[model samples]
Target: MGSTIFTPFSQKELIPKEEKLEIYRRERKLCIGIPKEISIDENRLCLTPDAVQVLVNAGHRVIMERGAGEGSFFTDLQYSEAGAEILENRKDVFAQSLIIKINPPTLEEIEWLQPNAYLISALQINLCSKEYFKKLSDKKINAIAFEYIMDEYKQFSLVRLIGEIAGTISILYASEILAQTNGQMLGGITGVRPTEVVVLGAGIIGEYATKAAIGLGASVKVFDNSIFKLRRLHTIVDNRVPTSIIDPKELKKSLRRADVVIGALPRINQLPIITEDMVSTMKKSSVIIDLTVDSGKCVETSELTTLSNPTVIKNGIVHCGIPNLTSKMSRTTTKAISNFFLSYLLEIDQEGGFENQLVKCQEMKQSLYMYKGRLTKCTIADKFGMQYHDINLLIF
Candidate 1:
């Protein structure tokens, strides 16, 4: 029979067999926005003038609102010289293709953003409300929380840098506070014994706090719930500082003798490690700098305060719980943030912009809470009782 006598599946050879490849997207020229921080305490700028110069040199336009860098002491002239366009109206900055900020945008600022604008900023979840997430989602913004963004090492790079600054600043701040409160020095003298510093938690903040305190010639001890963290810290500090697994009794005992307490623990909704009673047990006129207060109060007595009115006296102990405490050195923090951000934004550009970045970079998805009006972060979804969408499913 002539069945199957057809010539090699009929016109199969006529069909073009060239292997199809993905359409290569050229690098994007992202327009970056830098708005003036609305809140006074949010003194850090996302990009320094040098970063602006880098982005501009890479064929991108930078738009900064007038006085955006005043807090960081980076003048508009500097940005202008760096090839940034200074806009008189702040809303104009938010209208750009990309927005990089130290603080999350205010509701008004969010509304000002063009739909689908890429936002890179701190989430500061504790400070956000359900409505805040809703506003971002409603805007259909592509937002990434810089706080949760991880580096190649799977570490929160931005948070660690800021934490490092916060830790060192915590000790320095305590020194000034101690002198004012009781005329006591922070470090040891030749004859006098070394001043005591009690550091809570053993994360990046706690570790840096320990190092700074030790450097200042203070007798130091660290306490944390995790034995692993404590042990790691012990090794990191060369055992110069004693480490404990947060024995309540021992903590209370140490607090009594502690001249400075640096609360570096990452506490959220959970009850603080140091209760009010524990704080009360500390010596009078002792200084407590709660570095983690932005997330939650590490010391029960510590209340979130502004930079202008930073310290509060309660139980005869001076407490400072200023969020963005590292912003006290606005210039330094700005520079560090700028360095991190310069690389991050350029990577996004090299990847062909944010959407392509989402498709390719898993680490970027880790920090994304919202994508095109969908809730992508489980933590934010759970907190707000909103529907959670896995970013992976939505993107790919």
Candidate 2:
């Protein structure tokens, strides 16, 4: 008899059934770290008891560092009732959990992280120290940064919603500053209105600033490099608000007319786009609010401003480049931030677990490090010029 020939089933068909069964057997735990200091803002609450209820119902254990939600007016007792275990020290939370932190983790906090722990936070990895990045790699931890994720629209996914809120609030910030200046009331003035508002970049922040300016009754003109964005803004605002694509000649004219200019430009290679010459063209008493100061100032003459000294006159314009504008409105900022974290948590929970779903999530795909103590994220490997192992091969 001739040797029997047989065909084998493909590996892909046999894989998912085992993977699903494995995921079903594992339990995922999440720990949230929030700051204390409710006296700063009362309207904000991080990881509400309601969100805890959802996690608990999903068969996950939720832990909160003692007073984590105190800054947001959430009590330890409230979280306990919602089925969360409260730990007294922040260190314990990091040691035992998949951590969710609002701010970048401190060096001490980073040291406490368990090996292979998943850390979700607004970690400015590009700006962080090489030592810190090395520690992250050494710990074999997966750091998922909220700022890097893109949404369905392909804009900064996690930040788009929060950016809108921040952008809208930024106008209120400018209004408060405007009220103190010599400018006339935003909307009530008729002849030679008090404020001539110039919004830079025409992104979410610029759009909201335009809306807020219109509501405040200010003469608003928006500027951007993208003619498409400018055209879109003109349509969105029904041409009631004026927008201009930046040209050197037109920029000089616009700056000369602007009394208050909001800089909403995003960061670009740590360089300032609004040159000093452009700044000098503005009115002597004009206010320049640089919202992009977080990435570094957009205005060439701009410097970092704190809540205490939020404005400084430079080259004939008042420059307001405060780093933490959202922090100024902690109540709303905290709630918005908490909601963002909730969305991420729900995504992980719904996908069965972080480890399993991470492969499927485009954002997590970029953020992942080691699966079973092997490197991932090519950027990290390339930056360090180190050898990397494929996570799929290790996991499978």
Candidate 3:
């Protein structure tokens, strides 16, 4: 050993003791709380084997509740082989790590959640009760809602890539309902030569409905409050689809010519856009597909209908307002959802970790609600009558 030790130019620095300790504490693990009580039809598996494989490759541990995938035809052995740990009880999974779920956490399930655990799920929070929010606040749980978050374009963030799939299939769903009705085919030559199709709220669902209608050779007219979105749709469709900025008066006039009306409006806490008078104006033999019926309907005649009994004649117009339209086409919906999950996981993996990557991404940041136990989503806070804190302040 030389007594003359080497002296460095100071390009390399040692990590702080605290920083190294923090790195050691950061582990990759997640728990998936699936409702064993809820029967997963063969069509809808929350996390497919392919998705599990991606997660496994990312070096994250997945803990799943027993029988969680039973409805989806995925046995415990299948998930185990895919590198997921199978836990016997739902509470154990909830208590362990970050949770990813297809449905909203139930009251009982939320009770099992560990404090400060992260959850990724659908926009079922809105459907949750005041009690649920109280529990959420008490537990210091952080959540990312898949539905309300927006991408760069301010569209349905989670549903954007999958919207066309959901939208296109909605037409098939509506068609199935329409087929059961006494009304004639959409593009019949004789009576009602060009079936007058009215698609309200020219968003993704409306655009796809327009496409489906056009494909079926039916005349399509799209109504929207946003002239901007309507114009965008016009450009995308090459002006082939006619769009109208909805005037309440004009809406009445248009309904008279409509053979099939599709409501694709976003949720608003107000009276239905289509009043009984508007429904009365529609042709007696016409059909109404209320896509927005999930968040309270746009059509006055619309009522909640299940896939089992999907249609009812209200005010002499056939109405269909099934909540889970995509579920009707489960194969495509599940595959699309699986692809999204894979893409989301890969995006996180590429950036090192979900917290570091997601919190830094501006689009994801906008969707973030709480960071390090501080309120970050102002809109949600305002909606829920809670105090808002700037995300930057919370993170720092």
Candidate 4:
């Protein structure tokens, strides 16, 4: 009765209310490392001198191992002039907070990495063994594949760019190989029949390959398992190119008359679309360029080869399965890669810090294959027979 008679307490006094707001963290300066690629066929560099300059201007430290940019034709002096420290010992470079390179680090290179360092590189899963993942996990490193990195639009930006380059380069390489193999031209001449190019798959690589082949006056035909992709490719190419479903019989017939066959199919299963028998039926001395060799080739005869020893003659056909075809234009690819990395790193820095960015950025989350010591990608885990953990669980 006395309590009921007392005056009611104010809401502030009852609840002890206090104003609170989210904290905005200060931007962090990163220490980025660029190591020289030891892989003979890897010619592209992840970051350019101009990109280093931009990072340096933002107060980040960039460490370049001596000759890190040599493959891409960017001199050490260029990187130095742009405010990067050129270290003689590569291990010292790997000690940086982040390491960015064109190729994934070898086991020896991984040994030099500091614990929990951020690794940005291509995860050529075809080349990696289970032991590779174990080593990276043991080090508790965070690995993000540039190839797997998605943009705001959900498109794989670097992968598509590289595919575009590889597509064009595939046709160019076919032209050279055709001339050297049998002295045949790639395009049609006046009053002469046009060279026929059969492109497998209707992805980015296939579309660009068709464009390049068509531009050179070659009649191009595309085949894909997906009718939507075939239609998309037809529309993308202005509906000028012929498209077909991947009918084994039709493909065999086309290959028999094809002057150049470009395999651009994404890996569906473990096997190639074109059997050895199919390859045998192709015109003698014609070229086959498999742009998807990194994933798994679409041509049975194609083997992964380096740039130095690219083409292999088999079944009287020139088979070129050099996966990193864009590496031939190292400087252009380096610039393109650098453009992506500069923007990405800048965004990370602007977001305050790596952990802060991780908390707020979906793109970075999508890019990371590993977080801390756990495998965050199901594909990698399945490939290696390792347990998978969702990256969201690891971070948040």
State, as a TM-score between 0 and 1, how close model 1 is to the true structure: 0.94
Comparing 2 with 3 on lDDT, the higher-scoring candidate is: 3
List candidate 4 segments past 4 Å from native: 1-18
Worst 10 residues of 1 by lDDT: 1-10
Q: Which candidate achieves the best lDDT against the true structure? A: 4
On the 0 to 100 scale, the lDDT of residue 197 in model 1 is 96
Provide the clashing-pair count of each candidate structure.
Answer: 0, 3, 1, 0
Candidate 2 runs further than 4 Å off: 1-46, 125-127, 152-155, 192-194, 367-396
C-alpha lDDT of all candidate models, in order? 0.87, 0.69, 0.70, 0.88
Better of 2 and 4 by lDDT: 4
TM-score winner between 2 and 4, please give it. 4
Q: Least lDDT summed over 10 consecutive residues: which range in candidate 4?
A: 1-10
Itemize residue pairs with steric clashes in candidate 2.
44-72, 151-157, 184-194
Error of 4 at 94 (Å): 0.9
Question: What does candidate 4 score on TM?
Answer: 0.94
Q: How far is candidate 1 from the true structure (C-alpha RMSD, Å)?
A: 2.7
RMSD of each: 2.7, 5.7, 5.5, 2.6
The positional error of residue 173 in candidate 1, measured at the CA in angstroms, is 0.7
